[model samples]
Target: MSRPSENGLSSETLFFTATWNGDSTRCVARLAPAVEAVPVFPAYDLRAQFEIMRLAREKAGIPAPRTLWFEPDPAPLGTPFFVMERADGQVPPDVMPYTFGGWLHDASPAEQRRLQDASVGILAALHQTAFTAEELAPLGEAGLRAHVAAQRAYYAWAHGRRPIPLLERAFAWLEEHWPDEPGPDVLSWGDARIGNMMFRDFTPVAVLDWEMAAVGPRELDLSWMIFLHRFFQDITTGAGLPGLPGFMRREDVCATYRELTGYEPRDLDFYELYAALRHGIIMARVWQRRIHFGEQPMPDDPDDLVLHRATIEELLAGYEPAS
Candidate 1:
């Protein structure tokens, strides 16, 4: 629904400003309609997304973009959209990935450590935020069981006709190795990754993108943060570039998280694998969109559509504890 604007990138989100009295007053994000035939995830709700952002900023004390208003009527823009205050800062680029070489990669070890710790602190704070049962109702159910159920629904929606065998096997693996006792759930910033955050002075100024926001185990967010960085690092290294290899290592993230919040991180391997599975579903949907638009051809093997098919293969090959 949102068109290309001078302020922001051309994606499901757009940025614009209100000009009054010959001066621009404030910048706002128009959470636009997704062009895909169906959302990457089946549970895409605008009201829930808006309320999640609002609660993260106000209730949880996390640095999230403040949502101003929502217009449910699609008559104005052909689709319902919500306007949110824009946060200004640098985003670690996905195209040239920070690990490939960027301000984050160029920073000193201490600065990198500071950034990593503060980012994890966002998770700690959000997980610690106390909310009423009424507020939690709209959000996804607690723990990994609910997450698996939702993902099953998503994969079902995403993989209707041309099925991806790799994803099916990954689901089977998850069922076989389900954790004995999953941790308690919290207000997980569903899309918890550095690229979703705007950073100033290596600290998170604002957290953006809460469409994936839900109530799940703390590892849901922590593992996502860890996996995304590893994904970038893998891409960087694959291209024969020295990436931020030591940055955001799983052990380091776990240690930092444990120190910040008294809760010790548990079942990280399970969660990181889960993160990869979730991301694989998203990437597969992206490929489907690309194929629909003639951006790319459908591969002979559907698993090739998944960028990290190897990750799924390796994950399925065995389950190992982090050293």
Candidate 2:
């Protein structure tokens, strides 16, 4: 096992990678210590959230990080951090190696179909598994509502400050098209996506990043995944693959989800539109953080800027007049 490297502040508090001793080899662990340094409002106590998720995973028979240790504050290690048993797999979001380019670049329709199936299957299993709402009662309905409101407010503030027309439009759309009946409440992984899961040999090995995990409408999770694909579609055409692997068509995703879970999909258009707006808002905040911290230069990616702008326009276009 690789010896533990000397621990110290190296990067942003929410995320950092470090090598640590494993049973037989050095294992690299990514740490999301807390939100102590971020400018956003605290959603939940990071330590507590991790504990809840860990317990939830065990109860549901889901493969998640086994929490080795954790603390509420920066006492033991000068920061709130948790250690978990690292699993072996590749995160789909990272840059794919050249060797992977063959299948990635020239993927047959059949192969693409398989990838989509796996993504849907994993999410279905996640939502279908049992985990009592009572266990998550600490984050009450009000708390969940506040979480969504906070996100909306944060984006609106960003839009007002920057006066991005597209963002303003997206906000308007979201307000108009909010779901009428958002289905049964379930544990929603706030940021559900293929990028968040680790896969080995094209199969999911572990689902990571439960920092934003909470109890909410089941459709919230589904919408997030569907919107993620749409977000990517906005950025590029068929010329070159982006950093993340493209899954099957969005229709296929929704169909597969319905087949696996026995719940008919609803308001896909509204949800997808909401997803795009949500993502744009989140990215805006991320950009704001980078500028506030002077961590790096403001993004210069024209594609990203346009995509966010376009998402806003799309949102506005989908807005319905109030009765």
Candidate 3:
């Protein structure tokens, strides 16, 4: 096996590529070094997240990227970094060769449907994992409430400067209709969306990006996946991807979920509303962070703004006041 490189280092290295030895053999790794200049958040603890996900994947019997090593603080690489085994495949619903553009067009309808179904199957398996109350004690009611509060605070901070009426209304609504019982918490890949999975021949080989992995309501993952599909549909339609099947329209995805878990999705409209708000908040933060970094030429597309605004409206529409 080839030895890993300990070459150049920087104060805030955001990108680096290297090869390292793993338990099995050699593997390639990429590092998204620390952003010391920017504000840090709970989810920034990538190392802790990797460990959580590593254990969750093993327990759930899911194929995921192997996390070889990680550090929480800046030290050897002048920032926190983790090495992981790279999976060979393509990110679905992406604009890459195997996804959008002419690639999806070349593929038969069945092939496209298969890929979509596989994506849903991955979520089913994730949500179906059996985790004990003792094991999930760390992520009990307090943790769930904190998570929700943090999200609300993060979005408030991001939108505080601009004060979008729709966003404020959505945030208020989310607080009002917060689930009475979010159901027994399960291991949730907080960002369980198609873009985070690798696919080969219309099948998911590995799920990636567990930075937000945590014990949460199973509906959290489901909502994230569905909302992502909606986002892709919007983007594909905007880009003129003709004949592209709606990523979340097929009932087979939901059917498979019910069959695998023996639990039909309840209050989907509520969760979908929350999902949209969550997505919009995240995106808004991304844009805000970009501005903070002096990255100009922000998205000027009115339609993009409309999509986010519409998401906020949907959240408000689904809001039911607390009794």
Candidate 4:
């Protein structure tokens, strides 16, 4: 047993590298949030994520890491665990962010462009996956509306009494401008950012993290990837660093996806705001959890709990996709 360098691991998981019978293994031993278990996932059955990865790998031919076994019995490790083959590659770090400076930062713009296009290609292929009704059932109530409602439920659970007005306002904004045609629902990789994927030679070799997988409009995943990259890039440059400005532009991303899938991405203003709102809710929860652990203080303004308060305001102001 070994622990990988602690630099870039997911905060929500405890991981260990092990030998999987014969294949080298990376075991996802537990989901340990600071305050509570993720409300979206069920306690009894972890079948949803395992099956999602299988469908992506076997049917869609995506590079999702192959999960080996699941031991739902908590007696083994004090928490239920699963083992899967460890993927080898570099992942963009969420802490400092790859946009600040690193291997990906050192890569030429051409290589970065190659990585960008290839990453979106995974989403294009992922949407093509034929999911069973059983699969969709596990992903919460059907429809995009349900997805938003799930977020609302999660916020109520996460915040307890200290409601984030910014998040609530964003939710109201969503209600006011709901898409007339949200388009057909597809398999949306809920956390569809390059940061969740492992890349080799500027291409994705292993798509990691399916915790947020869902059945929704194609734009759900598309906007998530675009908004997250922009989120990091905005933060990096705000601190006087030269973030990857040319990468992951909304127009460029939509064009690439349209070229591959033959459907123009629509209602992205709604989805991207939805994406930021979703992230704001999560970030606010993370802050409140830190207070729970005495790692941080309760802020004077509750909206301050959300790291991207200004971004949420700007998004609320309204966005017109770059021409």
lDDT of 3 by residue, 247-316 (tens): 4563666776787788777666657777787777666655655667778545554224334566455456
| Cα lDDT tens digits for candidate 2, 201-309 | 5666777666556676666678887777656554544436563344545677778988999987777666666667667766666566666688766555422433366
Which ten residues in a row are the worst by lDDT in model 4?
33-42
TM-scores, all candidates, are 0.92, 0.76, 0.78, 0.91
lDDT of 4 by residue, 151-266 (tens): 88878877759888889888888898889978888888789999888899999999987878888899999999999998999899889998999999999999999988888999
lDDT of 1 by residue, 108-224 (tens): 999999899999999999999998778877785777787889888888888768889998888887887888988887888888988888889999999977778778788999999
Specify the poorest-scoring 10-residue window by lDDT in model 3: 4-13
Q: In model 2, which runs have C-alpha deviations exceeding 4 angstroms? A: 1-44, 94-108, 142-147, 156-165, 238-246, 293-307, 318-323
- Itemize residue pairs with steric clashes in candidate 3: none
lDDT for every model?
0.81, 0.60, 0.63, 0.81
Model 1 misplaced stretches (Cα beyond 4 Å): 1-11, 19-24, 32-39, 320-323
Ranking by TM-score: 1, 4, 3, 2
Pairs that clash in candidate 1? none
What lDDT, from 0 to 1, does candidate 1 have? Answer: 0.81
Q: Point out where model 4 deviates above 4 Å.
A: 4-45, 319-323
TM-score of 3: 0.78
